[model samples]
Target: MSYEIKKQRILELIAEMVEIDVNEVKEDSDFADLGIDSLMALELAVYLERDYNIFIKEHELMNLRKVEDLLSFLKTN
Candidate 1:
């Protein structure tokens, strides 16, 4: 998939995981700052796993501070 498309999908999944309107998710929005708790992060991991087939370890999630982190990870790995 194109990087932009992948990024968009990532944002969409994140929005869903957080139960927020997709329009509310900004590219630079920090995951924790989005009001996502630990349980929500795990939920996001599961959703992203199903959506992109990316096996995101818990530690890796910590490295993900913003939506760009996710896009970069998907693009490089």
Candidate 2:
């Protein structure tokens, strides 16, 4: 799939995992700002690896405050 499509899917996944609405997700949206804590992030990481085969280090997740940042990281790695 194209990066844009994947980006949208990632957004949906994040929203679902966080128990939020998908429309609430934005490129500049910060996870913490959306009430996503480390525990939630860990869960998100597990889902990503399991469903998308995208592995992410816990430390790296610290830098993933924004949706755009995560997408950029995924695109690069």
Candidate 3:
């Protein structure tokens, strides 16, 4: 899939995992700002790896400040 399409899907997945309205999610939205704690992030990481077959380190997750950052990482790795 295209990068943009994959990015959108990642955003949608995150929205669903966090139980937030997808409309409320933005590329610039911080996970913590959206009420996503470390526990939730771990859950998200599990889902991402399971759904996309991508592995992201927990420490790296801390650096994922935005949705685009996540997309870029997933795309490159």
Q: Which candidate is the best by lDDT?
A: 2
Candidate 1 residue pairs in clash (backbone atoms < 3 Å): none
C-alpha lDDT score of every prediction, in listed order: 0.80, 0.85, 0.80
Residue pairs clashing in model 2 are none
List the candidate 2 regions with Cα displacement exceeding 4 Å.
Answer: none
Question: TM-scores of the models, in the given order?
Answer: 0.76, 0.84, 0.79
Error of 2 at 74 (Å): 1.1
Indicate the worst ten consecutive residues by lDDT in candidate 1: 68-77
Worst 10 residues of 3 by lDDT: 1-10
**Candidate 2: global Cα-lDDT?**
0.85
Q: Looking at candidate 2, what is the lDDT of residue 50?
A: 87
* Residue 22 miss distance in model 3 (angstroms): 1.0
Predicted candidate 2 versus true structure: per-residue lDDT over 1-77, tens digit per residue: 67788788889988987788999998899888888888988887887788778899978989888888888988987
lDDT of 3 by residue, 1-77 (tens): 57777777878888887888888889888777877788877787887788777888979988887776777788797
Error of 3 at 30 (Å): 0.9
Instruction: Judging by lDDT, tell me the better candidate of 2 and 3.
Output: 2
What TM-score number comes out for model 2? 0.84
Q: Predict model 1's lDDT versus the native.
A: 0.80
